[model samples]
Each structure stands twice: as structure tokens, then as C-alpha cells.
Target: MLSGKTLVVAAGIFLLGLVSFGEAIMGGSEAAAHSRPYMASIQAVEGDAMKHECGGFAVADQWLMTAVHCLPAGPNGRKVVLGVHSLSQAEDTKQTFDILELHNHPQFNPDNYDNDIALIKLDRPFNSTEAVKAVAFLRAGGVNPDTNAEVETAGWGSLDNLGNRPDALHEASMGVVSSTRCGRSDYFGRKFTGNMICAHKLCPDPCDGPHRIVDSCDGDSGGPLLYNGVAVGITSNGGKKCGQVKKPGIYTIISHYTEWIDGVMGLQPDA
Candidate 1:
């Protein structure tokens, strides 16, 4: 049931491609991709227990935002792990956190991926002392308003572009692109909208697709789009495949729902 609008959004993303706006996938620098501090160990909907879908932090101790696609259908899904950077030791006793509650857009269209973002309330506030620290959010109107910014994104999802799991976390850096130009791509023309952000390809763009970044793929959805030390967006959807130069990775624009996020999550608006 891909609505025409959803298809248009997908087409928009396919044309724009994943670009690093204002920063890289690992924070602000390319070297920061594999770096800790900004990373989080998310475990969502693993069978009956909390499944370990990939997600990361935005505020220092409050919210853990993610892609709605990570949520398991129905009430059977669960969440685990909270503040940890190393997957090798993420399962260690002290680093894990149980599920609190899950919040996804009520009108999410699975086919169209509208409202693709979600929040995982933590059972307990994140500890001040941990290898994984929450990322910062761009002040209400402080950053990329429409499209195109230098930024970074990171995740520990399955490395293989085609698979749905990953052995550990990996990071990548790239730049953002204009939404207007995004629609001109062979795949995603005029699909860009106010809620979606695009990342263009790099010199050695690995794979080739309108909706994917060769450096990052599946399992990384819901991760952060950090620009200048702020978590400004969340990974949304990729085109049909990974690494098509014609395609780029699209993300949920964090600013679009400012009031809804503050209102629903009960957080103060950014000054």
C-alpha cells in the first residue's frame, strides 16, 4: 500500500543521496565515526525480550530517539541496553537498561514510511558516567532549516548492505544536499519534503543507489544525524538497494515536529 505521497518521498530520497551535513555520522569529524562518547547501545524487540534495534541518544539523559521501523509489530516487542558504546561488552550486566515505553507516529504508513521516527523511554535516566553519551540537539531553529548541512551519522547495524543485522557499530561522514536538487536524481526527483533530509555521495561513493550510503546501511536506521555536535535528524529509509549513486539516505527532519516532540515527550522547547 505505498501511497502516492510515500512513493514520492522515496523517490525524493533516491535522488538526493546521503551527504554529510555540517558533520559526519560519528559526530563532527570523519575520525569521530568510530569514536565512542556520542554512541549508544540500543536493544529493541529481540523476540519476546527487548529487541535490539539500533537507536541513539539526543539529549543528555532524557530521550533515545529512533526509526519507527525498529519497532516490532504489536505489544510483544521489548527493549534492552542503554548507555554503552562497545557491542563486545554491551551485553555486560551494568550497561543494560530495560524498556520503558515505545512511542511511534500513530499514522505511520509502513509502505510510505511517513512518521518514521520513534522514542524509547528509558527505564532509568542515563548515568552521568558512561562510555556512551547522549548527543546534543540543534536548538529549535538553530540549524539546517530546510536542507543541506555538513554532518555525521553512526550506527552498529549489520554491515552487509542486504542483511538486517550487524556485528558491531560503524561510522561515516558526509554532507547534506539541497532538497530541490534531490528530486532531479534518476530515482528521487521532487520527493524531498520538509520532513526529510538528504546526504549526497562522496568522492569514493562505495555502493550505488539513490537511497543508500555505501558507508552505512540497514540496522543503522533511527540513528542520529549530528550537525555541529547536535542530533538534528534520524535515519528514515533507503531506496530499494544499497549504494546507488542515483540514490541517497533520507532521514526524518527533527525540526519539523518541534511542537509535537516537545508536547508529546513533555520536554521544554529549545531556546
Candidate 2:
């Protein structure tokens, strides 16, 4: 029902800087230090410096999960920063690893963002500690949270549409929106797919302003969307603005790709 080519063209437009990448935690508060040990900061390694590009979460001793779009088109000069709360502060618990392999979903369509998920294998397993741990994820055939269910997401992305980002990690609490409603004509329309999930927190009053809405914005892509402490989704995309009314943040449903995840992790499915 979706055209990959069309989505590719749209992605191309984004690459040309015509449209902004929807990824960040708008109107959220800073997370407690090292509270989200599973959180992973994906950074692009530029000469003598590293720039935060997207968010991710550790899924295994050597594996992290994130949005496929976060991976560079050519040679990935990326690294994962784990067990960190503030990117600017150096903590003794901080751990860094070079990316050994990047496995993007074979069917991923960047244009439309369908199957917009990927797995990153670190060069070595993490040395476990209080500030560095792996997160549990939804398995294939797992039940998804019902509509309106409360969920949490964390990131080091921009705090607002003006592109203000914080050094410390920020988090937001929002509710899940049914795919049916998300696919409605007024929302994402036909662009929304079953493999995607939407989440948002409406402002108490529209007159209150966009800052009252909780959402993920630029630099937050590939972060986890948690439901009952389980990693259920990956931040995929959203509207042009961070917290637009009736337009929710979309995520790649992790449960939908458990098979692929298992394959990449070298795990066999239950018989």
C-alpha cells in the first residue's frame, strides 16, 4: 500500500536540508544522572571532535538499536557514548565504543521511513556497571501497548523548535496514539503504516503555546520509546515542527522487526 520510491524522494528532500529531521524531547525535563543507563549517544566523529547526531539504546552487551536514517550514507565515522547523562561533563562511568558493524533493515525505505530501524554492533562488549546496562526489548508476537497508554522517551535532542539542545539528557512522558487515528486524513494520512507507532501529549490549551506539548525533535532520532520499561519503539520521524497539534511523533515499532533483530544478533527464534 506504500511506495518506497516516493518515500526515497522525500528522504532525498530531507537530505538536501529542505525539511528538518523530527527528533528531540520538547517541553521535557532533564533526566537524573545516569538514570537511563541504556541510553546511547550516537555521535559522528569529525576531526578532533564528535558531534551528537542521534540517540540509541543498548540492547545487548555489544548491540545497540537506532533508526537506520541515523547511519551515515557512506563510511560511518560514528561512535556510541554510553553511561552518560550530560554530554559536556566527563563522568568516570562513561564508556565509548567504535561501531564495528551497522545493520540496517533490508526492507527499510528512507523516503517514507517504513522499517526505519537498524542495529549497531560495538567493537566489543560493554563493561557492565551501574551506569551502563542493556535494555529489554519487545519480542516478535509481543503485545503492543494499547492506545492512550502512558509511555516514556529520553534523548539529548533539541528542547524546542528553535533548535535549542541541552547538554544533559531530557525525557518526556506521553501517551500512545492508535495507528488508525495517526493515519487519518488530518494526521499523517496514508503515510502512517502498521509498522509505525505514534505518541504525543496534547497541550492543556492551544493558547498555551507549543512548548506545552511533549515530543521528540531534531537530534533525538533513533532513541527508544519505552512502555512498561520495555523498549517498544525507535524514534523515527514527526512533523516539520517539534510539537505540532494533532501531529504526533512517529516511531518504528520494535516488535515488528524482532525477527530481523534476532538475525542480526545471531539468535535463533523459538521453535
Q: Which candidate is the best by TM-score?
A: 2
Most accurate candidate by lDDT: 2
Tell me the whole-model lDDT of each prediction, alpha carbons only: 0.61, 0.86
Q: For candidate 2, lDDT tens digit of each residue in 1-271?
A: 5599989987898664422323323357889898899999998877798889999999999999999888847326788999988887878988999989889888888777899999999999999999999999999878888899999999998887778889999988889988889999999998899999999887543313433678888898999999999999999998788777677899999998877888889998979
Candidate 2's TM-score: 0.87
How much is 229 displaced in model 1, in angstroms?
1.2
Q: Write the per-residue lDDT of candidate 1 for residues 1-271, one digit (tens) a residue.
A: 9999999999878544434221122121123323545565566455454444665654546567777777746324454454444554434323556657778877666775667778777678766554556666664566673454566777775544436454455666667866766567565765555677777445433433323334345667778887776788788776765555556677787777677677767888655
What TM-score, computed on C-alpha atoms, does each candidate reach? 0.73, 0.87
* Residue 264, model 1: Cα distance from true site in angstroms: 2.1
The runs of at least 3 residues in candidate 2 whose Cα sits more than 4 Å from the true structure, single-residue gaps closed, are 1-26, 72-75, 205-211
lDDT of 2 at 126: 98
